[model samples]
Target: MMRLRFLRPPGARPEKEFLARCLQCGQCAQVCIFDCIKMRTGFNPFTSGTPEISPRDAPCHLCMRCSAICPSDALEDVSIEESKMGYAKLDRKLCHTWKGFIICRSCYERCPLKATAMVLEKGIYPAITDRCVGCGVCEHVCPEQAIVTIPTRFVT
Candidate 1:
């Protein structure tokens, strides 16, 4: 998958270049405060060691846990914003609740971008809409590891 770079302000360096040096060992993923980062199998193998952020799947709250522990430059100094960061996408098929199993919607409850970001459907298994902000709360708290914050360009 091609690495995606958002528009940076003046004098800002390419985030991909920083991510290029990442080892993708998942060390940063473990230390992240908001659980915004995730590992991907396919994509830029060149920077495979780094974790990626998606606002809908896992939004970066700027807690800086991942960047704090990054051994490489993968998560170098960079500012995070709701609009700039692509959010998480949910796979209902992989979700425990969608599978007719009892599961908590912590992500839905913890979302900072409620209403517009996450809309709940009334059904036996409620569906979360694409409006989700991709906060890592669900992925972070999930015991099943069903959700992940995939790269925006690489998700398909």
Candidate 2:
């Protein structure tokens, strides 16, 4: 079975440190302008009520509000480039542009970091760059569902 993957709010520390510092106060959820942050809902005491972002439902806009309002410093105040929420991986096999079926720039046009995070290789195929902070905008805008955001916590 595939493990359920979800992103933490921007500027989230490493999983262990984030859990230790998190107050589970829901302040991050309350302050999210995009309503991207949701308190984890489950009976598991270890993870219940922790802030999580489901990028497909709603992607982080990188406004930095949630991190700024986190009183426990569980979510650090960091710039958009430093957020490190996750990184986007594009599947060339499923991508419309890469497959040569159509020129789809949806992911590239919607990416907050545009040109920097998701670039148009050969001015056509969308390519993820090393600068990607994994804000999930690319995954959210992908019409072909060719993009996936691998959460930073899981990557480490």
Candidate 3:
């Protein structure tokens, strides 16, 4: 499986404070310019109104649409820098590189952060760098599902 790196906001206080206040009414989701805001299934058993988005499915663009539309401050106001999801990891075992396939570069080629995040290594099959942003675009774009982004907290 591809390694994922989760980047919680600095000083994140269960930052669920914002999350807990949400009504999950879909207003914020509707206002998302990038469609990154989504409600999680069974995110809360007692309270079903909380909305959560998977940064892996669609990383927040920091457009602030969701935060602005949130009536209850369920989505806190954060700067793009404060809200980054962080680096992504590519599993050599599941990647086409390890499989000896030549069908995909979607991960390497599609990375929005470029050289800083997905640098290339020299080899017959090649490899990705350590600076990945865990955007999951590589995982989603991969036809093999060889890539997965895990929370950075789990690493090290």
- Candidate with top lDDT is 2
TM-score of each: 0.45, 0.96, 0.61
Instruction: Rank the models by lDDT, top first.
Output: 2, 3, 1
Candidate 3 lDDT, 1-156, residue by residue in tens: 221233332112243454456565877767877765554445346435444445556654446666666666655576533443445556777777667767467776776655666666663443556655354566667766766665443332
Off by over 4 Å in 3: 1-15, 21-25, 34-36, 42-47, 54-64, 68-82, 123-131, 151-156
Q: Once superposed on the true structure, which residue ranges of model 1 sit more than 4 Å away at CA? A: 1-59, 62-81, 123-126, 153-156
How large is the C-alpha RMSD of every model relative to the true structure? 7.9, 1.9, 5.6
lDDT of 2 by residue, 1-156 (tens): 212789999999999899989989999999898999999987778888899998898999999999999999999998899999989999999999999989989999999998899888888989999999988988998998999999988554
lDDT of 1 by residue, 1-156 (tens): 533542111111245554446566887667766555566546556655455654435456556556556666444544433332344556777777777677567666665565556656663443445654344555555555666654332221
Candidate 2's C-alpha runs over 4 A off are: 1-3, 154-156
- Residue 1 in candidate 2 has what lDDT? 20
